[model samples]
Target: MNVNGTLINYYFHCKRQCYFHGNRLNLEDNSENVSIGKALHEERNKCNNTEIEIENIKIDKLTKEYLIEVKKSDADVEAAKWQLLYYLKVLKNKGILRKGKLEFIEKNKTKKKILLFELTEENEKELCEITNNIKKLILQDDIPKVLNESKCKKCAYYEYCYI
Candidate 1:
């Protein structure tokens, strides 16, 4: 399965949450937040930029080695970073990126920009391990428990999970 920004975000929040969101449950019926995020993404995608390859995965913006992730709130930072890191890792794996930068756009403004770098061998190993674990969870027949209360509040799956 392809890992996208949302999956990366879910993984950062909680592995079990990622598994639940990705496999055992569906949020399409109860996700105004998700709809808003998608709208924001469509807005951002309107900006034109050159493309660069990172391990057969194209970096979204290539001109300045910048990866822009638009978010509606500051709370989205961690999730955004994880997604960017994964991109960086992909670039490193393909030897396509020496360095990268992250731009977190909030409320139509640049809230934060930081340098992103290639992951080391150990980091790649850890990433593979984590990805495998997530896949295992998804393949299971039973849904994992809700691991934390904070997750419920911010989760797009909140209605399906908590109600």
Candidate 2:
């Protein structure tokens, strides 16, 4: 599987998470997040003017050039941002978009706006390094051990890693 920039950023956030999710591991038990996200996306799709599910990217209110991503948890925020960033990077690389705004809807209510920038050469380089590191870790089949620290209290994979 060719890992894209989105997955690369995810890898940076947590190697074990990236491995479990990227490799299609059957870890998550509930689809509540998926269902909620789909509903929100369907709402955005209702707008006649808005391009709904264009290719791999979904543009909410296309006229406004806004990308809407619904998050069920704060833990998903970072990965969501990286996904938006990857979309922006692809758009810029293909000369389709110069800039855009990222709107993250939290728990079906709160909204936060972020400006997506064109990925700089340095940013790409750093992402590449992270990607390589993640690939190495995954290929080695080494699941990173939990540090049993305070940070684990908030990790989505805390339960899985702790054991």
Candidate 3:
């Protein structure tokens, strides 16, 4: 499988989760958190059809100056940031360049967090390395160990890792 934005996000959040998803374990549908995230995206898209699909990646919102990614939580900003960077690289490859914007909108919170990023030559190089690493990670014979962190509790693959 090609290393997409989700895989990039998972690589930072949890290697094992990335491996499971990359290898098509497909347990996210059973997670409430995943459902809520999908619902949030659907609701926002209904309000304004800013969502766009280009090749293998789907952008939540794309404006003239920014490629915005909407997230339900900022709990894993590193993961989200890398995911957005990967998207930026994809866009840059397609001759579409824009700054990356990550918006964290919680379930009941009125205030959202916004962070902006621009893909530089330095990061783009790092992202290439990350993509290669993910490709190798998922092809391994043995699964990665469970992360055993607090974040694991909310992960969609929690059961697979813990139970």
Candidate 4:
């Protein structure tokens, strides 16, 4: 199975979510927040000069120096960061090297955000470990535990997990 950027993001955000998605129990289509995010992604791609897609991964905008990821919000910035880093690793395996930029179109209450990252030896090693772990997690017979955090209130899987 291919480990796309979404899996990487979900692995960091919520293991149960990652496992559900990896196992093909998709709930994104039933989510209002997901709809908003998709709309934001469509808007972000409207004027981009170049967008590259590989399997399930989509690079929102690419430039000579950067592989860009556009996000609707910064609520899950760490997940977004790792997703972009995984994209960089994918390109590197194909002999293409570029930095990564995470762009949030809509700022959260406290701050505006635009972050840049580069793939390093350390990042590659960690991501490889994450990739393997995710592979194992998805194949397990049982779903991972629900996190039940404040974020769960907004998750698409909230009803499935709680009710």
Best by lDDT: 3
Q: Who is ahead in lDDT, 1 or 2? A: 1
Ranking by lDDT: 3, 4, 1, 2
Error of 3 at 107 (Å): 2.7
RMSD versus native structure for model 1:
3.5
Candidates by TM-score, descending order? 3, 4, 1, 2
Query: What are the per-residue Cα lDDT tens digits for candidate 2 across 1-163?
Result: 4566435645756666677766766444344444555676677667554654544555454344544443445554556566656666656666665444555555556566454544567866665676676667666666665556665555556667775
Name model 4 segments beyond 4 Å from true. Answer: 107-111
* lDDT per residue (tens digit) for residues 1-163 in model 3: 9999999999999899999999999999999989988888899899998889998899998889999999989999999999999999999999999999999988689999999999999999999999999999999999999878998888899887788
RMSD per model, one decimal: 3.5, 4.1, 0.8, 1.9
TM-score of each: 0.73, 0.64, 0.97, 0.92
lDDT score for candidate 1 against the true structure: 0.62
Q: Candidate 4 — what's its lDDT?
A: 0.88
Would you give me the overall lDDT of model 2?
0.57
- By how many angstroms RMSD does model 3 differ from the true structure? 0.8
lDDT of 1 by residue, 1-163 (tens): 5565556768877666687667747664467777876676556566653444444344557544445433456565666666666776765556655445565555666455454544567767767776677677677778777766774776676765677
Off by over 4 Å in 1: 2-5, 49-59, 76-78, 93-95, 108-115
Better of 1 and 4 by lDDT: 4
Comparing candidate 3 with candidate 4, which one achieves the higher lDDT? 3
